[model samples]
Target: MMRTFPFGTAALLMLFCSIVSGAWLGLHPAAQKQADLTFWTFTKIHYDPYTETIPTFEQQHHCKVDLQLVDTRAVTSRLQAAMLSDVDVPDLVEIPIDFAPAFFRGPLEHVGFIDLTQRIHQAGLWDKMVQARFAPYTSRGHIFGLPHDVHPVQLAYRSDIFAQEGVDVSKIKTWDDFIRIGRKLTIPNKRYMLELYDFRSAHLEACMFQRGGGYFDPQGHCIFDNDIGVQTMLWFVPLVAGPHKIAGSIGSGQILTQAVEDGYFLCLVCPDWRSKSIEKDIPRMAGKMKLMPLPAVTANSRHTSTWGGTMLGITRHCKNPDLAWQLALHLYLNKKELGKRYEGTNILPALRAAWSEPSFSQPRPYWCNQPIGALYAKLAPDVPFQYTSPFIATAKDKLGEALVACVQYYNANGDNGFEPFVRATLKEKADQVRALAARNPY
Candidate 1:
């Protein structure tokens, strides 16, 4: 009944833009009415900083920034609409990893972003950026865009319950240990130790990443159906079905988001970004939240999966393209300003140098102020960045459908059981990705 990832759709983009029409007129359009620079950004304090940061650039080099604030989801459609209308385009824009590949074609390509591959290399942070870029955006042979920080989850379980259940998480290292802990703590009518919902894919993929399944291969092959992926999902999906009685079956849907916010559920595998979201939205679970590295595959193989965040990009369209580039790079690449934005906005910084700061390494007032960031910050260096395949988007939709069907199939026949549904669900979707990969050769 829920919608899937709509990668290419223009309608969804429009819907997103429409939602952000109010609560601001933060632009300095009046001051820079004659400005030659135009930078388009999504609605966020992090993006807005570029606008404010430009005065320093302006003071130094006499130029004005004409920044257009937009919602992230609306970026693609607005650009597409601009092309069809042949309207003026901004000089700089922040396209998240999901929409970057689509912009690789058309007007963007014609008057496209200043490819900073050389500049990045010149800055000498290319290798460090490359190390973190996979979590932020998928890159190709040529580094496409700058990386923001990665959003990785730590297992935040109820410590009180763990103590009550005699579960020592420090000793419980494997996936099996996690299950045993989850099962022992699940007190049916009293509490659900784990809430596997529609959004459970985030957790599932995290597990898959621990087992070495990634979004794509360096050669861009589809490996979702690889044995590691199957086994990882098999470990949790069945446990959530019934006997284990994990929270009622909800995949990552809107309802589940609300449910988690309400504290209806106790434990969740949450990303760092959620720290801010929960503090604001779910005040009930504030101090109780505790962190753990994602439960490991071989215990000591602490490698974990991370969901990526946003990055900055310069559009090839401005009247002063080079000026735009300087400002974009200055704001994103600056360590001091990046740290300010990182701590204040709950937005992490992309500058690799920023991580070495005492601020990042130390425990915090928020997030239990644990030194967890330093530990979970090491992203897999070789994640496949070439996400340009046309079928990747479709596969996301189909995968959502497959997840939904599993829920329906199990709910209908929980007795006859999971093998029938699991086999039918995974193989069909997995084969589609494999076949698509073969044809496109990603």
Candidate 2:
């Protein structure tokens, strides 16, 4: 049950004083003419709760919001062009946590984005907003963006199938053990364990972190080619050709939603925020699909990793950044307004308090009545700040090409080709980054 605080007769005077203090807070000057605030976003804004909730904000602020969908492909160059040309740049923009490092370089200076440094600190939520779980990502000891929502990886498996197969959940402990039992549960036609995409598999960062690999050290060099990287990659080879091979492994579609097209795979790996997508896209399986903690990797390790999610932010560019930040806060805190959206839309809240709400506490049977909140909280500690670089991004392109060369050795189950390609790519990136640093482009 949700708790409500009530004022007593004795405290009424105090309450009156508090209410007056709060009510007298900052009130902006009224605007007769319309003002437009341009917001650039990657997600189709209308589809996301943060996007849809803006109308209420616009109404309150008496402003018209023009939203644009910005694509990240060739993003730095596009941002550079906008900066250099002194042309159109959105008043407020969304950039993922991974790309924050690149912005730290200099592309952001010309944009006139209001430095939220002091404001966020004054709000006292600097840690919670920009420096939350992913603390390492904040550059130069200043917080920049606020989390949109977190979609940490979680387990999605068919309870009905597990029951019939007597695959005891407690028995599955490690990923290796997971593979072993998954191999046994391969009932030929019924269910063949779990499915996951070889590429974009949650394992990429999970294993990297699991084996003590940081995406970048203080020096900002990609070390994904180290032992942690090698071990992480090696873990996937078995799953690709193993006895309990995942669904659509032959082609594409290795995740829960992706495998939904065939319904051949009984289990899949997905993020906790997938409730909205699962319900809307796979309605037929409603009340049947179950959510569970990612099974353990080691007896000591937690099976969770951040995959995809975003946060809200007020760019330094906003003319009324204070009000903009307030609106951003309203979207997260206004229980009646934001709360309704979260419940109605099945979107997860990034705020810690939101989860304790009754609406969030209850379980949905379609997901096997999994203890969604409790399980997800455990994964929170492991979430890291994603790092990106011009060198790393360019290297990823080369890595994609390198995957083709690795394919032959991969097909032969040798695991030889990927390393050479990755090594060569990383060496070039390192050299390039070193030279760029020497030049000090900033």
Q: In lDDT terms, which candidate is top?
A: 1
CA lDDT, candidate 1, residue 399: 55
Evaluate all candidate structures by whole-model CA lDDT and list the values in order.
0.59, 0.57
Error of 1 at 380 (Å): 8.2
Task: Give the CA lDDT, 0 to 100, for residue 327 in model 2.
Answer: 67
Give per-model CA RMSD: 11.2, 16.6
Worst 10 residues of 2 by lDDT: 399-408
What is the number of backbone collisions in each predicted candidate, taken in the order shown?
Answer: 11, 13
lDDT of 1 by residue, 1-442 (tens): 1157465457777666666553244432335357767777775655566656677778887876667788887887887677567676666677765566555443324534556677677867676554545333333444456666556556666555566667776876666677776666566655566665543354555566666665456545566656665565555566556455555544444655565554445577666665555556555545555667666767566545555456566655556656766776777677777665655555555556766656556665444556644644543332223233334455555555566666566667764766656666767887777776565422
- Error of model 1, residue 442, in angstroms: 9.6
